[model samples]
Target chain A: MPPFDLKDRAAIAGAGASAYGRRLMRSAIDLAADAIAAALDDAGLARERLDGMIVTFGSPIGADADTLAQVLNLKLRAYNQTWAHGRFTASAIQWAALMVAGGMADYVACLASVSFSGLRRPMMGGAGNSEGAREAGGSHGEDPVFGMTSPGAGAALVARRYFERFGATSAQLAAIPVAFRKHAALNSAAIMREPFSAGDHQASRFVCEPLHLLDYCLINDGAACVIVTSAERARDLRKPPVHIAGMQPLPAGREEFIWAYPGFGVAQQSVFDYDAGAPPVYKMAGVGPRDIDALFTYDAFSILAWMALERFGFCKPGEAAGFTQDGRIELGGALPMNVNGGLLSEAHIMGWNHQVEIVRQLRGECGPRQVAGAEVIQWANAYGDSLIYHR
Target chain B: MAANQDDYAKPRPAISALNRPYWDALRRRELVLQRCGECGMRWYPAAPLCPRCWSRRIEWTPASGRGRVNSWVVFHQSYFRGFDAEIPYNVAEVELEEGPRLLTNLIGVGAGEIRAGMEVEVVFDDAAADLTLAKFRPRRGAA
Candidate 1:
């Protein structure tokens, strides 16, 4: 029997996005139509050739994969989706790769189309917040009973703990968002590209204390799509195939908190000295943290960036507060991160935007913000899911 | 004085069969957590069995009503209409001595003064006729 590894087994053929804005005034399906069309066009693949789809979020948040297939008039052989969660972006892509690799589908469209504009009420943290309604409480430490609503508040809990445990301050945490915004300034499609300073981050009002308004990701509406197929299929397509070199699925248990790494201890997790110790994704890719040309993450909140850095062993726990500082995570730095402006300034496409950027960056499509000679990039997250890609 | 009792529009716990006993004890002005009779493991938000050992033997026993502030946050935005008046209210995650952490309000202290590891004791807040919530206040001396 031959040894098997998923390394370079699948590849992203093409990527695309719809206009991102606070009030796109378009429906989720409408945004998805553009993204799907654009991705198919980017890959130079006809609409009829697309066979599978995996949507990260559906229904109340965006268009379902089933609906996208119907409305977009796509011929699909397989499709899947998860609930309304931005964290599942990596999960959807991984599944799409598996579907294409296993011959379950030839070309799988992995994407999320979210049009939050013109809603009756805010879906995130106000009275309409549905996260707290879960029976076992929300996954993000959202307990409506104590007014602990919104995903950002849960992140605030983690930020406060990190500050106390690591002697970090809100001023230091500013670097993460600041760097992402700087990257956004280079992109033409980003929504919040004005580029603010740490002082502005400090001056911003605390939506939840210790987490200023800047700390939160924008709630604008938009969509992004990626086309996945086997490495052989991707090579035959238009653009250079960004190979799926490694994959690590999300983790759970008592030690898991959506916002913090284990032992950094937010919820029921026991506090201990967390050691990154070369996690699997790095080993699977046959590369270390140093091999990554640029890094991307689900920056739903600024604190999550630090958590992702520490969780992926980029830096030790309690060290991201410093590791993220002094232009380290910005373009031209040692290890640029979230170079597509991330979810922070790039329309919160539920991390679909980051994936699009990764694909384009690997293809050298990003004009100014592209990492020079970017051959490898990793999408690691605070929630412990990751995917490593290469040109 | 039950301040929250005046207008309890704030979000309340959903008391299901699994967690109703914990809430019932709170309404009785007692703080209790489920202790695994087999493993002696204590926890909050009630489970059918021990999370550690999955023991079917479980009991609701009184907690020490003592804890330390593991973490806390102040809200400048109102997420709930009931909490609108208390715009800058604080939610403190107090780690009870029994080993489970609870999301509760930190009372009798300014949000600015709250700190992780600050000793706290529970205050049974009768928010409404049939509802009581566990809140926390700094422990100045031994109970």
Candidate 2:
């Protein structure tokens, strides 16, 4: 196989996001259309210019993939349903970039929108806690016989193991939420914009043991979209395009997914294991964890975010708690992460906002939340339940 | 206490051609896996081609019902109503004696005792009408 070179391959020219706060009147399709139109306008591209589109598998009603395609009225040569959940929005952009680079399509639109506003599904109506509610998604074949089911409760088992192995404390974990919320406060689009202290995070109600309510991401109705095209074409367009410098997917493995249940705490046991496929997401972008100008991580759950910091080589394994202490992840730290408020404050539209923020940062369009001289951005797509948390 | 009685109403897993033999073997209280006839690669969720060499020559073989727990989680919350009655059950990823890692459940033991690399033996759950599911329990002295 040839080496993956993304120089002038594809570019993200524009990004748009719907109102992240609660919106009772607009349907999911409307949110998607608004975001799509805004993104196209930002890219200075016509509707007919798009030749490919990608949408999430878990899109809410009215915001489904087909619905967005119909609303956009763009004839698509390629339409891919993403499984990255929210994190996949970035994945979608990556795939679209590949498509554009390989001549499958010239322009593509990637969108993720959900309205947990009026959903009645059990998985949709997560337990009041983030992890607890997520655990309740699929049927437990035999694990249920002993009363094991809630996500939070399930995650607590892993948390217990992590704590036991590393001597990590809940107080240290609480810093993740405190730091994320602190960053979100500067974001006007963020939902939980108020400043929160570790004391406040500790004082919040416990959703699961070691996981306070503050550690969980909130669900809200929102949509975000971005346009991807060849870098040459993008450079000719009106807006600045963030080139796809490096893109790759990490293979699912025991460590990546079921870390809580690894054999000897090592990753090589699983047959599906393949660390070779892991794209050097940080290094390929010509930046290291310390060199990242700003971060737009998918903060679907606080643990997922902290784990990403560890997985992407930002902090040493089991040191994310200390890595995020004292408003470090907020701003003016070694690396400022998730300036858009993330899922906790922004809206849980499946990390699409993370994509929006990356584009905005690349375009230097982020207002007061903007990091100085921010040239590069790093984000991820995460999926799965107890197995894989984030991509 | 039966929180997931409603979740059972959902349809059971559909067996495809690649996996039908494995599921059928389960109905007969046997654990089955696919072995590449040409390359000696053992696998589960039986696929058409050998993952090792990408060869299509493979055969279905009965397993020894012996393996070790690779990793496991005890889920206490029910995602679906069908599993409400059986909350807090253990879903384990096991490395079979024949050399394939399969996702299954651990039976005949409490969830708390489950650990990585613990030796386990297969025990069939045949209560269902169409299929007999394969489960495992910790092997005595196998820890």
Candidate 3:
């Protein structure tokens, strides 16, 4: 079957996220409901108007679509649950948009919530789910034997190769978290608001060589929701609609742990390959990096944001360290990035907060953190799913 | 030279019926992977059929035991209790000459010395009484 063009058929009517921090003592279900209700309220839609729901999160936390539906009292015509780790939010948005555009549902809510502190489970080990544990130990039987057993370790391997190949420095990579923290200082809901200098970032303890503790994202308890509806319906909603202009899922055949084992060349090639294809997101939306007014790539780790900057063609490969060095990614810079502080400082809702930030920036509602006169925005995840949104 | 099972308590791979051959070969100090009888394509983490051609005609073939370091990392923190004493060990991805990558440790070299594209050869570690792991070390005389 030919791919359907999803450009501008549906729009994000509203977005909302619960207060984010460590150990909020809230169940995943309650957090999801909080965000969902807030989104409905933001859209000025009654609960009965919701026809579909999408729940995305770590499966071990135990809130599935049916349970969330029961908790939110949602009787839906359609629903889906995505388990694609960090890309869950973007994947859910795509599915929600398709459902709305295909007549499967009129109004859909995409929700994601996580309570890392509440679960008290380490990110890796036998104590966690079997799949995560297996992958942590090296899916092919190598990593566990050597004691490299966390996501941070896997990402650090890629960063190390990037440094060796591109001559990028740890001090330069430190600019990422430093800039995001600066933006977080302006955000009232951000978890880590204290500003730190490059020296401070450099002095931070190493979680894995080449990645300081500051490079890791916060483990928090929070949830975020975005409401989607047809463009016509969104026009009549309470807030300005953020159009779903274009989106592209990760190109086929790239594994989730592509960065862990593939050489820098392979990782770099995949990004360039996808861009060369004139991916559906760019082709259907009629936009490119040059047209985007703001950028919001997933920053699960500081290096991820750096990789996105290079992969998305914002700068030449191996130049992101320099591109991000001179406030270029800070608010009011050439390309404001993670203006809502991103996962690093804002919160870790599995990139759901990024979508919230996009809607807020396009609606011109971010107050102090808003990018002036922003219209077009792009959000992407490390796995390569990208969506372009416009006001 | 298998170690007692009690020596290592970390999470072990759940060997399935499909992947039993791969693990059994490791126990015998040899490395083997799935190769499609039809397409001649080889893959790791064993499968029942050729991932490339979907052919049930498959066979287990021994690897060349030589590859280059594709990428690597050193864990500074221990996520599993069994790894606590081994913090800061290196895990590397070695791309074999025959076109499959394996996650293993690079021995006979410091984590600081490992680099991308450095040649490496396979070594076996009997991590537990019933489980033998495939690891790698720098190739002699290769920088």
Leading candidate by DockQ: 1
In order of TM-score, best first, we have 1, 3, 2
At residue A44, candidate 3 shows an lDDT of 96
Listed per model in order, the count of residue pairs whose N, CA or C atoms clash below 3 Å is 0, 37, 2
Give the winner by lDDT: 1 or 3.
Answer: 1
Off by over 4 Å in 3: A1-4, A124-126, A133-145, A254-277, B1-3
Docking class of 3: medium
What are the per-model C-alpha RMSD values against the true structure? 2.1, 6.4, 3.0
lDDT of 2 by residue, A1-391 (tens): 3466764478877788788766555677778888888888888998887788888744434376666667667788887885424445556766787788788888888888776675555343233222222221222112232233344443444454456556777778777677777777878888778888778878887654445678678867778888888878988887877777655453444233432222323212343312222336644555455556776666655766655665555655567667777777777776787787777777777777777787777777777877778876667432221101110
Against the reference, the lDDT scores of all candidates come to 0.90, 0.64, 0.78
Q: Which one is best on lDDT?
A: 1
State the DockQ of every prediction.
0.78, 0.11, 0.49
Candidate 1 lDDT over residue span B1-143, tens digit each: 36745567887777788888888888789999999999899996678889999999999999999999999899999888889888899988999999899998999999999988999999998878879899999997833
Tell me how far the alpha carbon of residue A136 in candidate 3 is from the true structure, in angstroms, after superposition: 12
lDDT of 3 by residue, B60-120 (tens): 9899899998777777766778867777767787788877777777888897888889999
- DockQ pick, better of 1 and 2: 1
lDDT of 1 by residue, A265-343 (tens): 7889999999888788888889999999999999999999999999988888889999999999999999999998988
The candidate, 2 or 3, that scores higher on DockQ is 3
What TM-score, computed on C-alpha atoms, does each candidate reach?
0.97, 0.75, 0.92
Q: Scored by Cα lDDT, where does model 3 land?
A: 0.78
Off by over 4 Å in 1: A1-3, B1-7
